[model samples]
Target: MTNPAISICRVLLPALLLSACGANSVVISGSFPTPNIGKLPIDLAVVYDDNLLDFMYTEYSETGQEEYYIQSGQSHIQLFNAVLPAMFDNVTFVDNLEAAADSGADAIFVPNIEEFQLALPAKTRLDVYEVWIKYNMRLLTAEGAYLADWELTSYGKTPTETFLTTESAINDAAVVALRDLASTFALSFARVPEISDWLANR
Candidate 1:
C-alpha cells in the first residue's frame, strides 16, 4: 500500500519544480493622449538608430547561471509611431537621413536609447522589479545641421506582492516606464523655448 504522505509529495514536488522553471512572456504597449493645442506646422521625419536597439541587461543566479533581459525593438518603434502623430500634424518615419531629406521634411528627429536596465530584489520571494529607460534625442534640419538636443529618463516599479516572475515584473515595469517616457517627450517638445521659437520663426 502506498503511503498517502509519500504519494502527495511525489505528485506535488514535480509540479512545484516545473512552476519554478517556467518563463514569462509579456507584451508592452502604451497610448498617447491627444494634446489640447494645435500640432506643429513643420513636417518632421522620425528616425531611430538601430545600434541602440541591441542593448540588454544581464542577471546572475545563485547557481551561477546567467540570464538576459532584452528590450523589444518592435515596442520602441510602436511607441514612436503612436506618439508622433499626436504631437505633429505632418510626421513621417524614415529609415535613413537621405530618405528623410528626400521626403522634403523640414527637420529630422533622431531618438536613441542610451540605457535600459532592470533590477530585481535580493530575495526571489519579493516578486518585484524596477525598470529604467533613458533616451537621447536630436533634432536636425534637412541640411544636416543640428538644431537642438534633449535627454529623457523614465522609471517604474512592479507590484511587490504579485504572483509574477521576475521577468514578468520587469516587463510590467518596462511598460510603465515607456508610457511615462512618451508623455514626457510630448510635454518637453511642446514647452521647449528653442523649439517654440523655431516654430514661430519658421
Candidate 2:
C-alpha cells in the first residue's frame, strides 16, 4: 500500500476495534472541576515528580512467530518542561515551593499521574499492551491552603507492531496520554476564553 493508504489503515483499524467494544471502549475519560479562582490574581507554578519517567516499562510480544516490543507512558515531565515557561516566566518549576510562592503567583498547579496501564486485544492475534495515566492537578494558595483539585485519568491500547518494538509502542502510548491530558487541561483550567482559544490552536 502507498504511504497514505497504510496510514489510513492504521487509523481506521483502531476505530473499528474500539467501536466494537462500545461502552467498554472507554479507553479515555476524566473530569476537571471548575477552579475556585480565589480572591487574587496569580501566576501558576507547575511541578511534577522528579522520577516521572519511572512510570513506564518495556514489554515483549509475538505476532505469528514474529517478535515485537512495546514502550510505555508519555514523558509528561518533558511535556511540562516544554509547556511551563510559556505559561510563566522566571519561575523554576523544579524548585522550592516557597521560592515559587515568593515570585507572586496566586496558586501552584502540579501535574501528576495516578495510574497508567496497558492491555492487548485478545483477538488481535498480536501482543497487546494497555497504558493509562492517572493524573491530577492540585492548586495551592500562597499560604499553602489547598484551593482546588482536578483529577484527570486517561488510558490507551497498542498491540505489537508488525515492525516496531514494544518499547516504541509504549513511547507512542505516552504521547497519546499527554495529548489527552493537554486537551483536558486546556479546556478545564484556562481562566480566560482567549487563553483557551490560544491553546486549542496550538
Candidate 3:
C-alpha cells in the first residue's frame, strides 16, 4: 500500500521542478531622462571590467530546492549607450586606459559592478525576494588625472509565491535597479564639480 506522505511527495515534486525550470534570462530596457547639462560635444571613452560579463549563481536555500543565475553586463552596456549621449556626444569603448587616451577622448569612464545579488524568498515570509546591486564608477582625464568617483547601490523587494513568479520578480527588480543607477549617474555627472571645472577649462 502506498504511504500517504509518499503519494503526496510524488504528486508535488514534479510541480516544484517544473516551476524551478521556468526561470529564464532577463533582458533589461528603458529610457532615461537627460539631464540639463549644456550641449557640448564631449568625447568619452567607456571601459568595463571583463569580470562584469561573467554570470554568478546563488542557491535558493539550504534545502537545495532551486538556483538562479544573475548576469547584467549586456544590460549595463545598453543603458549606458542609451543615456550617455546626454553628456557625451562621442562615446567609444576602449580596451584599456592607454587606448582611451590614445583615442583622443576628453574623459575616460570606468564602471565596475561591485556586487550583484538576488536573495531567495524570505524564510518567514516565503513571498518576497530581495535584489541588490552595487556599482563603482570613475571618471578621469585623458592623461589619467582623477576627475570624479561614484559608488552607487540599489536595493528592492519583489513578490515571489512560486519559482516562476520569483524569476519574474527578480528580473523586474534588476531592471528597476539598473535604471536607478543610470539615472542617478546621469544626474551626479551633471552636478559633479570636476565636470563643471573641466568644461570651463575646455
Candidate 4:
C-alpha cells in the first residue's frame, strides 16, 4: 500500500511551490509635512540624476522563499520637494551644472541614493519588515565649489501584523524611511559645520 505521508506530500508540494514563486512588488508613494525650522535665507537649486529619480530595487529572500521589488524613486523626490521649501527661501530643480549655475540660487543641493536594503520577516524570523536607505548629499556654490559632502542614512520598520500583505508592509516601511530622511536633513542641514559657516557668511 502507498504510504499516507507520500500521498500528503504529493498533494501539498505544488501548492507550496506556487506560493514560493509568487512575487511581491510595491510602488511607493510618500508625503512629508513642512518642517518647523527657520528657513535659510538663500535660494537653492536641487539636482536629481536619472538613476535616483527612477530607482527600483529587487531582491530575493535569504531562504529563496520570496522575491520583493520596491519602486521608491518618485516618492523621494516628493519628500524633498515638500520639506526643502520650508527650510529654504526658495527651491528650484536643475538639469545640470549649467542650469545650476544659471538658476540664480545661492547654492546647489544634490542628493544621490547610494544604496537600498530590505529585510523581510521571513529572512529575519521576526514579525516585521525593515528598510534602509543610504544617501550621498552634496552642497555646492553656484560656481561649483563644494561646500559640504556627507553621507546620510535612514531606517524604518513595520510590524508584520500591521499589514495583511507583504507588499503593503514593505511600502509602509519604505515610507517611514523616507520621512526619516526628511526629518534628519531638515533638522541637521544647518548644523553641519560647513553649512553653518556658509549661512553665517551669507
lDDT over C-alpha atoms for residue 71 of model 2 = 23
Model 3 Cα lDDT, one tens digit per residue, 131-157: 788888888999989998878887766
Evaluated against the true structure, the overall lDDT of model 4 is 0.88
Q: Is candidate 2 or candidate 3 better by TM-score?
A: 3
By TM-score, the better pick of 1 and 4 is: 4
RMSD for each of the candidates? 7.0, 14.6, 7.2, 7.3
- The local distance difference test score of model 2 is 0.54
Residue lDDT tens for model 2, 43-133: 5665554445444333333434322222222346555555555444333563556766775665666666666555554435557655667
In the range 1-202, model 1's lDDT, one tens digit per residue, is 9999999999999999976775444445445454445577779998777755444445556675555435555677787788888778799988889898888998999988887776778644554677888888889999778888878898877876546765666677887787788778877895666677787788
Q: What overall lDDT, based on C-alpha atoms, would model 1 receive against the true structure?
A: 0.74
Q: Rank the candidates by lDDT, best first.
A: 4, 1, 3, 2
lDDT score, candidate 3: 0.72
The ten-residue window of minimal lDDT in model 2 covers 23-32
Instruction: List where candidate 1 sits over 4 angstroms from the true fold.
Output: 1-37, 53-55, 60-65, 123-128
Residue 185 C-alpha lDDT in model 3: 75
Tens-digit lDDT track for model 4 on 1-202?
9999999999899889976778667899866787998988989999988888999998776666447778898899888889989999899988887799998889999998999999988778998889999999999999889999989999999898843788888888999999899999998899989999888987
Clashes in model 4: which pairs? Answer: none
lDDT of 2 at 23: 28
Q: Rank the candidates by TM-score, best first.
A: 4, 1, 3, 2
Point out where model 4 deviates above 4 Å.
Answer: 1-22, 63-66
